[model samples]
Target: MPKSLHPDICDKLRFSKLYEKYAQTLSNILLYKYGDILNPSDKVQEAFIKLWENCTKVKPEAVKTYLYTTANNMMLNEVKHQNVKFKYQQIKPKDYTNESPEFVMRKKEFSNRFEQVLSKLKEEERVAFLMSKVDGKTHKEIAETLGITKKVAEHRIYAAMKYLKNNLEELNKK
Candidate 1:
């Protein structure tokens, strides 16, 4: 893969100027929509890279629309997948009845409890937990990225789970 889009490639048939201008525009749109869920700039960059790879097929005028559409679609899919996972996990959201004081209190309590439990974990265990359970990285991938053996990755993840379970139990009693 080419590390960067070459000036020569961009200069061809005025595609370069269009790509530059619209790339920024597409990135801004993506940032506005998905900045909270994921890295919007990363998604835009990925879309641009895809377009650049197929530059022969893509017209300059169409690049902006295509990039924005592609990034938004990808972000939508991500959100859908997250929703499904959250549902499957059976983690119920706090009940809210139109901005009541009780609802606000419950919401705050949940947030504080979650943070308190998470903060007790060791750094590596916390990272392993988030990567595996939150980001959905497989043990093998986590092991490879963290430069540890697969067994170590598994151990770290299990330890984190045990810690969280115990903490949740302790919280329930209080």
Candidate 2:
């Protein structure tokens, strides 16, 4: 934890050299992993800032892992927040042949009600559920992205499904 890197570490991670060597590569990795869901450039910048703040504590050899892990965690949190906020706002009807007006209206009504129920779920449960159901992520994938155990991911999704089912049934009864 030296304020200035020791000579050996400095060779690998001099402040200026660090960005030149690693920034674009890290950004590319995050972009590939997250697609358009996150701003890779922004996440990369944030990770660099964190790296700078913890420079003394981070070993030069481990800097790449540190940067990637930080950026990935940042992107995951941003994706979860944005996914929830943007979910219902961007709904679009799929193309269908000769649908009746009543059917269309009913579909919209059901969608709106489902969105309401989803919004009422606990944040962790909602995130897990949407990641699994909407994004087509498996429990293992969701666990990795969210930095949780697979068991936790499974429980969260199950809890979310139970809530949605019970609430939707109540809505239907009404």
Best candidate per lDDT, number?
A: 2
lDDT of 2 by residue, 23-132 (tens): 76567556645655579889999998888888878887777788888998999999998889897688676777588989888888888898788878887788788777
Question: Deviation in angstroms for 35 in model 2?
Answer: 16
What digit string (tens of lDDT, one per residue) describes model 1 on residues 1-100?
4443443334455666655665654554454344455676777677777777777776644565667678888788777888888877886666656788
For every candidate, C-alpha RMSD to the true structure in Å: 13.4, 9.4
Candidate 1, residue 149: the lDDT equals 91
Cα TM-score of candidate 2: 0.46
TM-score (all chains, Cα) for each model: 0.42, 0.46
C-alpha lDDT (0 to 100) for residue 170 of candidate 1: 48
Task: List residue ranges in candidate 2 displaced over 4 A.
Answer: 1-98, 170-174
